[model samples]
Target: MDVTPVMSSASTPATGTTGSLAAMAQQAWGALSYAARTVGVPAGVRGLAVEVAYTAVHLSVYPWGLLDEALRPGGVHAHHRTDSLPPYERSRLVSDLDGSSTPVLLVHGIVDNRSIFHYLARTLRRRGHGTVQAVNYSPLTAFTGDIRTAARDLGDHVERLCAVSGVDRVHIVGHSLGGLISRYYVQRLGGDARVDTLVTLGTPHRGSAIAHLLPPTLVPRQLQPGSDLLRELEEPAPDCRTRFLAVWSRMDQLIIPQRNARLEHPDLDVENVRLEHVGHMAMTIDPEVVHLVACRLGRTRSPRDRIAPVAAAG
Candidate 1:
């Protein structure tokens, strides 16, 4: 993505001042008020019951997502073309000041397939997003695949998508283990050059204890709390250009302490969005998560807009 600096003189009367103390104070007070209003867990009984039911639904849909989706020549379908949208629909869908047509790819968690993204993909298209795709990594690969190996494969996939779509950069949204894999690709494998934004939902950025409870496998071993693979990811990635957003849920059952999902590396630009009442498997279908993703992905990439969205839902 091109990094240009500044707004036109008409919008920002002051030439050099990027921020002001008074404005910050008002923002802080507003954030505090919003946080106070949203303090609760698991969205109450309704959310938990729905989460349980969705697991079975997702399982039944899993087989349908097993086959890799064929790459389209133009990256998106007929309706996703923004120019073809009717005026009213276009106004509702194109929220960005610069109208980014960035292609989005959804990566699923372990033992899950692209089927998890059915709701999210359709929602994004309705929001006027140009291209949305989902990829599946085989569960059989777990016996031989480690994080770096999977990351290498992911890198190749991103390159192909960029080429096929004829776009300079793409945004990635990874769920659970898929997030970790995408992170390794961006930070360690130089995928930052191609991936504009990387959003992780319920990913274990600090590693998770659940891996230790499960039987050892090539991938699970790498996901353990203190594994060498996780340690490597902890290393400084100051040069990575891709923006990071880690969306973690308080009710996620698979991530041992739950808090491990937050990405706190000092070197990277990361925004952490906290969620409540959503579980691991249910995150993709959750309305709050789907909306947050659509809003973030729809925004134009500018240096100024990259720093906000803190505790968006508390």
Candidate 2:
């Protein structure tokens, strides 16, 4: 017997084969779990999940509203070419300025283009509000420079809107960081005279801690609590003539401790409207908010009435 034991040619290593199959199964399960968490859970959750996903996408890939123009055909341009147009042509609003009451200038927040206001703009128009124009600032600008520059640009746009509409004062509606910009214009840039009413939705007037999650860019830094820009904005504005209405949501994920959206300045005329279960982005398109804004714009309030900060549950 040359070979003590003859190995069976057809025999397989059962333990090794079983171990490999188990490893593959585990890997497959991990992939499936990841997919479910990313796609399935977010789809079901809806509110905060949608906002978070949108924000993440905006920050990571679509910063500065890139590809937004592609999404919206013939919508408002990211950069208005008023400089090229004649005064007569430039003065015209999206809707007929003459027929509308007070012209409304809509300012979008960080990394957002004018398209974000499409639904709200249409709603305002349907409700018979005046010229609803939206402005888009460079997302990179917000990340690189002071917000005051955007406020200055806003001032320029406001002046143009007023000049074209033949209105002495225009109403301003700002969302998120745009609210901060409008506030800076009103408080620091002497825009109170030109702006009659300012309505802010989900704006962090006192700044937000969640800003820390963003890169330490100029505007993000400015948005952090106790930043210089916010401190300056907090200063007394005794002469500010603008009436401010702050609409904030309890479910807003961006503005941590959401009360930061309230305008707490003593000298300014401010009001707080609390919205429940509304995400930050949804505020711009909310029907109840739009109706409330229309009512505010439609009626004329006395100075005494505008001075007090009133809180209402929405």
Candidate 3:
């Protein structure tokens, strides 16, 4: 049996490993024209040129996120409450434990650490999400570990966050491969019990053709189209209660067709939103993405029957 990604025609460049990215940039420049106009940025080649520069900037940020983050101390745990407070003050404390105070967990993609959310976390806090934080799975897992094992570890992290935050549920924003690990936890490992909303940015929900270019290592093999792991995720998920918001970008060269980022399952409650001119790594810091994520977490907007292009205010 032939086992490879559906888009096997996506060939690597003769120059070397990175030459493929340069080729994708050229394609992105052509495809990004209309999207650039929508965001009032320079069109076509110029738009993707900026994205290339941002990719370099994101590389500088990778070092800062090398270590796991410490849990911020702000959860309204029961031990912290007291009876000596005024009635009005006590009521406020009670409200803090309600759904309004649900925690937000940020998960980074393969080969990355919690530092990917440096800007996104700060932006969420600035937008009034008090408990926004990130959990860094081991970077080695991207190449050497089973995704199922990683999901189990993530579930453990979620439980710890719940214990400290005094809330039963949380909202998650997973970038790229991080999104896959999180979904495996949610759908296959019964994580819907804890996660209320899962937002995946640049996640290849249907598998990415780019994985075919790499050697068939354990984890990368699973990321290829029609891999066993992807097949397992495609299985029926009838009772999943957690909501999903999948964000895909037109200028994301890493995901190959880019539409691979869209999540389309028959039984899951999902909303897919598309954006133009944003690169795979740029999803976290893009002003529009930050604004949309804030609105979703803050409950500023209701679910829509149709997916629409949203532009953030300046």
Candidate 4:
């Protein structure tokens, strides 16, 4: 089977390898328990249990679900094939972009691939941006683990794209965890030089209370604030060419305290839109959020561009 992701304007990239064997085991246990409860004991249950147990045993070998890519000749996982695209797809993308440097990269959130950006990318393309590339990465792995790797990978991709497309820099639009991942890339991995704009929709910048409410075994502790992942996100870095914008909603269920959506960087440009009655995931593909991102992307100014008016008025 082709394990590579389809090269959609909205497909996730390949996943990085995982490190936590214990966490994988715990996730397996929970899945098994849920399956047993759903089916109950009987001949049916026994048959299902056998399948479930078989799956559990294999989960250790394939945490990210690649049959052989995650093991053997691995430190970084091997690249696999996607049913959607041939290896030469990158060449075709260059041709599609027509050698013009469109200044946008869309990265999706946890458990989501580029598909989350399908509607938004199509709309933006209609608006006449030069080119758009989606960062596709698996989410089952730890945020700090695979995500960090993803950020680095993105940096490499950006370099290659710039070289091929003759674009000096690209704007970045991220939704939910994608936003966080984008921030990490720009701020920590020195992606600021290659990116011009950073727009985050429904990102949880300060960590989520909903994450805290979940059982520790069910979700990694690193998801909480003060954890390694959050701490890395909070670390200070030198300024770059990238401008920042964040679109927040009042009713984001996933981002508890809602204020978690706020960007802490005083140096980066920040904007907040009050999205009423919109949930976290909904904002990813919301038309209003997409408009806000496009508008922000079109602006060329310092991060402090609009701060004086609010401060003087306050």
TM-score of each: 0.77, 0.68, 0.74, 0.60
Estimate the Cα RMSD of every predicted model relative to the unseen true structure: 17.1, 15.4, 9.9, 18.5
Candidate 1 lDDT, tens digit per residue, 210-238?
88876688788888888888899889886
**Cα shift from native, residue 214, model 1 (Å):** 2.1
Tens-digit lDDT track of model 2 for 80-138 = 34455444444443344432457778888877766667677777665555467777777
Which of 1 and 2 is the better model by TM-score? 1
Check candidate 4 and list the clashing pairs: 4-81, 10-114, 10-115, 11-114, 12-114, 12-136, 13-136, 13-137, 102-130, 102-131
How many clashing pairs does model 4 include? 10
lDDT of 3 by residue, 13-85 (tens): 3344578778898888966764555445565455477677867877887776663343433322433333554
TM-score order, best first, reads 1, 3, 2, 4
Ranking of all candidate structures by their lDDT, best first: 1, 3, 2, 4
How far does residue 9 in candidate 3 sit from its true spot (Å)? Answer: 28
TM-score of structure candidate 4: 0.60
- Candidate 2: clashing pairs of residues: none
The reply for model 3, stretches above 4 Å from the true place, is 1-41, 67-100, 300-314
Clashing pairs in 3: 109-178
Task: Please report the candidate that would top lDDT against the real structure.
Answer: 1
Two-way TM-score contest, 1 vs 3, winner? 1
Q: Is candidate 2 or candidate 3 better by lDDT?
A: 3
